[model samples]
Target: MTEQLEKLNRLPLRDDLRGLTPYGAPQLDVPILLNVNENTHGLPQEVQDAITASVQRAVSGLNRYPDREFTELRTRLAGYLGHGLGIENIWAGNGSNEVLQQILQAFGGPGRTAMSFPPTYSMYPLLASGTGTRYVTGDRAADFTLSAESAAEQVRAAAPNIVFLCTPNNPTGTALGLDVVEAVYEAGTASDAIVIVDEAYAEFSHAGTPSALELLPGRERLIVSRTMSKAFALAGARLGYLAAAPEVTDALRLVRLPYHLSAVTQATANAALAHADALLANVEDIKVQRDRIVAELTELGLQPAASDANFVFFGGVEDPKRIWQGLLEAGVLIRDVGIPGHLRVTAGTEAETTAFLTRLRELLGA
Candidate 1:
């Protein structure tokens, strides 16, 4: 390992890429794996069968390249989103991260800049780095919340070429109000910024939470990105899509590699979309578990943030590392998240949630 590290350092790597650690979470094989914020519930048997059948049908056409445009998948995604969106307004990539990277490639590079609030998604900076875009970090409240006024002010000040808004944000699990999106968009008018609202966990948000999709009609600069990984239990499918103005997608077309999405991937995602209701049934169950985690964690004297995502992030651990290790020893694994006193856990199934909670309680000696 030392030799490899020395050799890597000696190579002529980009100066900006030097000393940057890759983004990853611990991938431990534990009894209750709730670390990565994936849907704990496996796919419904029916959805699984549908995907299998679709893949089988697509197998014969393996020799041919997938439709570079992915027209059918875009249409299906638009119907699923249903904010009066159409195929012209839809674009997709292997995952939301790729969709975001493509955006940076199109709108940010060299002298251009991309900005996002910290303790948000860790990938924004990494993606910016990969695209050779200047990365900027904005501030959030001590409680990890961002207000519309603060966000707008920050956007106006930075005037970045691109802005990333992670709704029901990762790690922290808090959702931004549409007002923040509106404010940031208005503020970015001076820079003509492309604002992206990442809705990876939108399906798990509490009742009546409005989506940024509602704000996309006239906002050609705004993009709302979604993934089939969480709510649809299709993490292996690797399908992420966005809804934006046709012109914005047109901009992406210049940068995206031809036939980037594979035929099997399209089949799997399309089949999942066909069974959206069945696949999303687990979302309600996960929400129940998430709320349970928040309530029970509070009762145990931990300060869990209000979460609209599938995961719960809580502070008040006197020793986060100790608790994390203790939970691991007991065969339950959750994310330590590197925060001083906070840890994040994906809400799992009823039994899995019970396992995590019971182990956590035992660790706390409660």
Candidate 2:
């Protein structure tokens, strides 16, 4: 082997990722985009103009690096969250995915383990493996609801260094109750594990669902991560923030590269914040679309789980690939999850939803 190849082979690349390709969602242009859970709406003209104006005003400062601390953006985000946790307890990264990695780097590695439930976000295991930490799975029960008792038992047994829980979980589109979150946090406390709750879709959740921020007061190990990618309609900006104890935020700061946020990204994010109401209105529309999709799928004899997130997850058919292929060929795109016979369809514009439903009905011969 060449010198470089020999040196690369000597490093302990985690065996879990030996044959796995890097993670990514398909980005092909199609008639309808219901694959990646992106908000169907784009920034309003006013917001776009404001962002452009902001960028133009700061064009002179392009030569200088952005503030490493990102204080202004942090303050805006703090105000947006409207929780007790202030900017002092906030941290930002290139994306929430990076924030997840920073949590693992700070609390888990080598002999330490990161615990999570399966049929959840696919990134948890990937993040754990990248940090050279053991990824422990506490598979959810048959109904796709988490078994807190079983999960707590696993936390007690494995004693992982970090725990990741995704509320309004991806692919499954199931939101764990606050009670379940508290139970898991309490369990992690017993083991002194850092519990990171990924609430990327918190905006789409049903009314009355408590945010993890509510638990930040007494739970020092609880870290709640939010992303502008989903509800805020700023996925292109690549901004995510985590709120937790100041000490936990400090730990993440230790590893985050300086000036992770670019001038344009920060400017656009601030613009998005200025138009928060507009984004939220869009989210409300998505919720309505979500409900309609779930009902439609149920009518077709498919059992879609009750979802508060922007997507619907259903199972029952022995092979969903036919449905998936049918949609694909018809120029509609959606996500097929790991669970056998399960599929995830994200809510899009009204027109897109109508086309998807029409295609779906034809595929199922309804």
Candidate 3:
């Protein structure tokens, strides 16, 4: 492996990517799989049947290239969001990551910078690098919270061309308030920054937690990206969409490939949305598991941040990797998110959650 890496390194590679390692969360097979924050619940039979039918209908259309505009899909997404939005205000891609990449391509590059809070999503920096945009990071508070004042301060300091705000932030599982979003937007006006609010876990958030979508009415620079991969239990379908101003979607058109979304993908996503309620039925159940993990972990003397997302981020570990390994040995898998004393675990099925917390409690005692 070393020799192979050495040989590959000898070849010409992008200067920025030279020493970089790929983003990876271990995809290990275990009796209880909860590392990546995916919904452990299986799709409902009704949704599965709908998807099968939709794909079958789309099969005959394969002879022709998929729609370059993907107009109907955009409309369906807008309706799902229900803010008087139209097809003009929506965009779809293979995944939220691709939507984010196209966003950087259009609004960030070369001399421009893309900024985000660290200990959040790992992919934001990578996406910026891939687009030739300089990556900048700000620090979150000790509790993994970012106040509007501090967030606005960073905006002024970085003067970044693009700013990413991940609500119900990855790894931390803390949701940002609209006040923070507005404050950051206010500061960005000085630099004309495009602020992206990644709401991939929106559907999994606790009830009454408002989305950044509410703040979009008059804010043209704001973009709220979401996905069916999590709460909708369609991770295998690979569909992510964004709701932005018509102009933003129009700007993305300049950079996106024609027919970037395939027929199969479009069919699959539309089918899922057709059964949105059923697909989302497990959200509350998952929330129960999420809360249970937090409660039980806290009872065992760990500090778990309050989470609106379907995962919990906890601290106070003497040895995170040891606990992580012990869980693996016990046939469960979780995430060591590179934070010093912290680890994350998705709220899997009830049985899976029971196994994880039970195994973790035993390891702590040992």
Candidate 2 has an lDDT of: 0.86
* Candidate 1 residue lDDT tens string, 1-366: 588788989999999998888999888887889898888898999988999999999999999998889988999999999989999999999988899999999999999999999898889999999989999989999999999999999999999999999999988989999999999999999999999999999999999999999999899999999999999987877989999999999999999999999999999999999999987788999999999999999999999999999999999999999899998998889998888999999999999889888988998994
> Each model's TM-score, in the order given?
0.99, 0.94, 0.98
Model 1 worst lDDT run, 10 consecutive residues: 1-10
The full ranking of all candidates by lDDT, starting with the best, is 1, 3, 2
Q: Show the lowest summed lDDT stretch of 10 residues, model 2.
A: 13-22
- Flag regions of model 2 displaced more than 4 Å: 1-17
Q: Report the candidate with higher lDDT, 1 versus 3.
A: 1
119-160: candidate 3 lDDT, tens digit per residue: 899999999989899999998897889999999999999899
The TM-score between candidate 1 and the true structure equals 0.99
Error of 1 at 311 (Å): 0.3
The per-residue C-alpha lDDT of model 2 at residue 82 equals 83
Which stretches of candidate 1 lie above 4 Å from their native place?
none
